[model samples]
Target: MPDNFNFEAAPFDTLSEYERNLLRSALSVGYYVPGETLIEPGSTTLALYIVLKGVVEERGKDDQLFAHYGPDDLFDVRGLFAGQTRHAYRAVEESIVYELNAKMFHELCERNAPFASYFQASLAAKRQLARRDGQNLAEFILTRIAREHLLPAVEVSADLSLGEAARTQLEVGADALLVRLEGGFEGLGIVTRTDLMAAHFQRRLSDDTPVGTLAHQPLAVVELGDFLFDAMILMTRQRIERVVVRQGSQPVGLLHLTQVLSLFSTHSHVLALRIARAETLDELQRAAETLDTLIATLEGNGIRLRFIMQLVSALNEQLLARVFEQSVPAAFRSRCCLVVMGSEGRGEQLLKTDQDNALIHADDISSEDALTWMAHFNEALKGFGYPQCPGGVMASNALWCKSVSEWRHELQTAAQEGRPEQLLRLSILMDAYPVAGNEHWFSSIQAQLSTWSDQGERWLSDMALAALQFDTPLTLFGGLKTSGERLDIKRGGLFPIVHGARILALRKGLMVRGTLARLQVLGKHGVLDQHMADNLAETFELFVQLRLSQQLAGDRSGLRQGLDVSRLSRAERDLLRFSLHVVKKFKQTLGRQFHLDTR
Candidate 1:
């Protein structure tokens, strides 16, 4: 075994000292020269090779490259299990590898469950394990309340004097005291030291005043087993300093905002708070630019794409609202509503893509005034790192920003005409989510559109038919099919699922904007089977994660150039294949439901 073999990487990291010794005992170093074949196709498998240095390539017949293996990369586990090589492995350059004896490898697998499962687990499971195996010092979202050090709540009777409660708080070094509610009330209430000070100074309350009058109720609380991230959201939303940690009805302790923030100091909520506090465009721009860095940090800390999206979505909305409030005149802003469309509206945006937003103003508002306000709003966002839509689908476009009646007329006309462009616009508009101003204006227009969709099956079919625009990027025998070695993930995987989900949601008149949420609602209402819905949701999440990985690696082409297939790991490639198959299945289901062929 080489002295520098990375025991901290992958399945090795899951091993115990006994298993490490077994691996070391059975490991032998092997060296290969450039163009030299390490394993010939169809030959009986020998040892498992982990690259120690240089490069190795896995090639199919005619020397077609599938993937490249570098230092710390393990190869041919499938071959070792099956006892035959499906692909030939050759050294791309001078290479050194540590070959573990096959018998010893199997013995280690038999001895260890996690080690064995790493070889046989599904792609999703493999990804999760791989993340867990990485640097986990920043992974705090899964931290349960019981796992962290919490402040003890000094429980006091409601009838206790304020001075005594204040004395007890000081003696116990507690910032807040829990008060048991009187008059047969079952829940607890809370009074902070600030409350005591305010009562003493502002109200000139007597020291003998009952703490019950000072305690705020009903108290905001989180369960003992709740994820700390959710607790943070609760506190942030409620604008509180602390929440009582409870096990069912019994109070356990107090978790403060400061305590949660200490672990999640660089978390998304911090960015949201920054955006919320920014009163100027320059201030907002400075905060918005760091969002990409934040995304990378969160991903590095092993956060899942769905949660990342959720947090980013909320932050982006806050940033947009701030932009609108600052850039638009207060008088004019009251007469209109601002909305984000497409992926942004769906709350599925991971990286900052193009601006797909619009304005819906009151019919009586002057168009000239509204246009001036929206132009500044759009430019403010562009300065804040949101790129303008290449298709001009932003609020600045006259076609998108319009009065209520104008929006209604245009939507009705589009529904009646059903042109390709009109269909595209309609699909985009279906996912519109109000970010600022009069949400009622956006809802009224959206409700009318839904009613229009209900009036005709032909229009709904036309919309659903667009979902099948691209073929799944898969070969007849289940291998990946790519253009110039790149797979357009948005076209092949994301579009089909998103559009299909949208069409179904529209058909049922469900106002939900998210693709996964729509699928859940559809499944719940029997429009889609629960099993299929769950599969599609998982598949969609995998596709989004894949795209985000590419984006994080500086492939900012986003929905344009697609994912570079050659850059994917074996597990990622397998997941991509599986997800594409799900897209195919989902498209077929949509086609059957919409009667596309008859059209």
Candidate 2:
């Protein structure tokens, strides 16, 4: 290796002899002159690069500049990732880069599990950013704003030539570059590998061709104050590969399309797709068994608990749809919607949880035969491993399976009157998320939801009153509250966040379906700040993982000791304890925001 040649780009500090030899053999090392274009804007190169020296710049083109990156930051990863190039890159100074050809990178990762694991996550993050807009917009209006969503900006003014830009992208292994424009922050534009290719094809163009000529303007930006859904929308509508994430003018992060979607992929995608393809109920069960294996894999890999819930939510929705498809009549299926309650509704489900579901059917055309078919549908889902809804929320329960008019009346009556039965009815039903069929039915009911938002201050008061139904298990001494021997992470940590997010969202006319989603939207309205909402979202996620690990371990070890609060590893216990405080603080925030009567 040449002097000053080092591999800070590698994720780990020390490498085994075999790995070092692999890197040495497979790697092509080179030094870039200052102002040499490392990668042309718009040219998609299927290679990963490691920077050994000097600064590299990543700028967004066409109004959605991503975060600027430097030494130790991997770039052009998407080239290594499924071989798609999205951004433009350049080096700010003379730089040295290790060009790990795509084929070599794949081989190295495949041979080394530790390296492969990190590589998988890195690639997954990119893919997620590519596919985030698939979510229903209306349903996401209430999600939490996350710190990760911040657009990253570096404060520097180094104008490198197009040649240098290309070289830098290759050096940092980045897919794109976002250059700082002289005017406003959003005035920043980006250049991609595609642009570089365009430059390459134009033989008249010189390495000295001012990259700024090709720099697209108006980097797409969402404020730190913007809701997460807004970020989702910007990504979805723009159709570009990444977003210029920002907090005011300063870039704090890059919201890569691939990274966002990776959050919901993994096991859930596997289960959902497999279950969809299965033809028989028995086949569905076999596919679902794959979930157990998936869970074990997830636990072994050590992903956070909150992310697991996202996987579970995606999987549950997928599994439910498959079950409904196999059992429900095609014509009637579109006329009905599946509603999940309890933990599933609150986005806190962990492990394989019990079912809390209800169905809503169109009122005008139901016959006894229709009822029979719906009943069979419910039973089919149960057999496929989603236990039937407790408390009769299942479609088989006549009280719960009502027509559109009936459902509206029930919610309106519950809100207007404030009786024990009505409160219980609304409480059980409010968190409903429609999974399959004529979402129009759910949308119709959603229109009515606003009816209470403006006029029903009393109803808001009542819901806030009922919100206290779920409690944080914080004890008198200010430590975590215990339920018998094991701490009830769900009630103590998760529920408070869910309920607070829910009540705040509902009171604000935010009709989002998930807790984090709700907090996200509310944050945009100044109802909750970004950090406040994200902390609560994190709290809910941590509790879920703790409880889920306990549940999964219980089934495997037969040690129903529950989660040993004290026995937890230091990291796990610390995260849980911190999350506990997050939930506690969030509950108080909700009460203050809603102005609920303490009495």
| Candidate 1 runs further than 4 Å off | 1-111, 115-123, 133-139, 147-224, 234-254, 332-334, 405-419, 445-453, 556-560, 597-599
Best candidate (score: lDDT): 1
**Lowest-lDDT window of 10 residues in candidate 2?**
125-134
State, as a TM-score between 0 and 1, how close model 2 is to the true structure: 0.55
Provide the global lDDT of candidate 1 against the true structure: 0.82
What is the C-alpha local distance difference test score of each model?
0.82, 0.63
Across 231-315, the per-residue lDDT of candidate 1 in tens digits comes to 8767655556788888866777888878887777666666777777887889999998888888887776778777677777777
Highest-scoring model, TM-score: 1
Error of 2 at 24 (Å): 37
lDDT of 2 by residue, 1-599 (tens): 43333533234323566776776776777688766667766676756876667766665577344543444446676656656656566677888787777887787777766566555543223222222232443223335556654334433233667888888777765566777657677567787768877887865578877677777777777665565545544553444556666665576656665665554333344455566678888888888777767666665455544454555566667677777787678878887876777777765565555667777778875746446766887777667666665566666777767788888888777666777777666655657777777788888877776555665556665666555566666554344456565776655665567766766766676777777677778777888877777666655555555566666766642225345675564335435555666676776776675676465
